[model samples]
Target: MTPAGRATGAGRVFPPLPQHPDPQAPFATSWWGNAWIGALEGTSLDAGRLARGRAYAREGHVDTITVAPGRIVAYVHGSRPRPYRAEIRMRTLTPEDWDNFLDAVATEPAHIAALLDKDMPHALVDAAERAGVQLLPGPGDLVPSCTCPDHGRPCKHAAALTYQTARLLDADPFVLLLLRGGDEQALLDELAQRNAHQAAREQSATTPGATGESLPGTLARDALATDYRPPLPAPLPPPAHPGEPPLLPSLPGAPNPTSLEFLATDTANRAHAYLTTGTAPFPTADPWHDAVRLAASHPGLTGRRSFSRQFAELARSVDHTPTDLSRAAAAWRQGGEEGLSVLESPWDPPAGPFDRARGALITADLPRMTIHHNHLTNASGSLQLRYGRDGRWYPYRSEPGRDDWWPEGEADADPVGAVTGMIGS
Candidate 1:
């Protein structure tokens, strides 16, 4: 059949795969991409047509693919002289679904971070599902059609295009999002606006008597003028002796004689090196240690107090409890380097969890799985199967325990089934 030129659509165009001089695998490397191909293969009634489609994909028959909201268009080279035009269409989420999904995304900061990093975290997918949004396509969700003589619902031409599209999805998850009815930039902008609005509301709620209104112009101006500026400093008198060195002030509160002595010795050494070699002192890499050193060398009560308050704020930002910070502080006071070392080391988990998980997998006759820390990782690194406290397996897209695991459907109780479902069979 002779036809016209390339297929055109109102969406982004993905260039055709480069011709492989040698035959290559048609399947996608990413699990999500494989899942898409799986849906296509599983839904087709004829295995022969599916096989032909895979061959066509492997041979690089599909031309540039166009993807838009709810639709995909492509040109596939067939037995005939002219390439056939193929199109695959999926149901786009409704406006209400998008709203619910966006709301769910707004509830978690990690969702935005993951998306920005080009990762689609399973936790975000679970949240969307809970919000009544189906981010991933299920069976029958994709409908394929091609302008070819073959009467098959998705002829080899269309199937080849679908398989190629999966490869595209594997490279860029945003393509999947765009297919679901969201423009990438628009989605990010909306998320940013929502987060900013939420922050403003929270700030207003926390402020006492905040009415969300600006003060009267004249009163606001007068208040700002009175409180915003600091008094100018007076000029200091000349030195009493031009040749004599200046005296330094004594530090207040004494601040542990041992710490002070170390500070004095270290500071003098650094000062001498700087003067002799014209080199600057190296800054401490650890913020906590730097803070302690600064506090130790501080000249007076005010300086020490400022550094102490700053250190406390830093600890709070890292989620350290008051007791934890106090213990670390005490360690610093007793033996500076040794105490910090104790605080910085990560605690080891008991071997019981790993042993139990391994035993379960062994009993299930899946001995190929490699154990890593509290999780089992596959060779591809796409699936992370974690052992939970409830004696069940959890599949995570990221590091286990860093975020919620992906939800298991019918295969929840079966560890092997869960792993297969996550990364595909």
Candidate 2:
């Protein structure tokens, strides 16, 4: 039998769920879908209502579901002839909050890559949370309503609709993004555009003559003539007093003495191999995995702290601040090397006067060419100059607990002059 359609609002129609001879699956296969169900079950006060809702969902009572930013609407078949209308509304993130969330996502390529692969990593969600944008709905966020006479916050009909929606979310994670005020294509396009812009800026920074002025004849010739290969370090001499046995250094009051000795010997052997061969014996392409392997072999270092220390050391080697390393560590812990790479990857500065200024800085023969949001970072990644909305460039330096782009100097309209002055200082 064909179910009747009910007109809810302008051009919005809710069609009843098709009846099947066999009962449908009770829950979604995906973790996200299960998370939705968990959220629903966690909120309901009455166990009977939830049980009935599960039955209603399994029996295919839910109709075609419609989801929009901040709203979900559906119809569920019940004992009554007319279907019950159900709607669930979630408070959407504010424009500023969304901007901040997007900024965080843009900073890391892995976040977008994970979403593109239909996997929403917890790291991305945590980053959004830190940015004051709640991507996932919490207990109080899911506001449910139903036309059914039941006084429960989410009547069985509404619960059934939500359960079905979770199934939809399982199929397409972008539905959550849609609920968060952006369509899939729109978000992808925005990310692509941002990535491309950043790539272009990097290219411009690298290209020798892309800027208006060409390098000086002597300098260009000298640069071309210079040998770029690094000189290999001299091998260490054999340990003094070769006849004496090498002592295993022991930490005072250390536990597991034998294990510590083995670990120390293994570490020294590996270091010697790396020094002699100029390569790792068990080389891994992934630094995170390499660190984990090292930690596994060591007695004291293990778990998140070990991974974090390795990540911090790597970040420091690349001149990134501790704050940046902390974010990277969080991403790595949540999503491994892919997450770490995302955080490490430089994002393009937002389109504005900043891009032109950065281009000008590159033209002026400045080293290091990363443009992040309104800030232009030097090759060292320590010094930064930010372009303010007031049409002035302000200087900044990396400092712990001061992650925000706080300007330290007088603002100047001239980007090139501002950068030059900062560099000179």
Candidate number with greatest TM-score: 1
For candidate 2, list the clashing residue pairs, or say none. 17-63
The whole-model lDDT of each prediction reads 0.63, 0.62
TM-score to true structure, per model: 0.47, 0.44
Instruction: Please report the TM-score between candidate 1 and the true structure.
Output: 0.47
lDDT score of residue 82 within candidate 2 = 40
lDDT over C-alpha atoms for residue 255 of model 1: 60
Model 1, residue 72: distance off in Å is: 0.3
For residues 19-64, write the lDDT of model 1, one tens digit per residue: 5434565467776787788778778999989878878987899977
Q: In each prediction, how many residue pairs overlap at the backbone (N, C-alpha, C within less than 3 A)? A: 0, 1
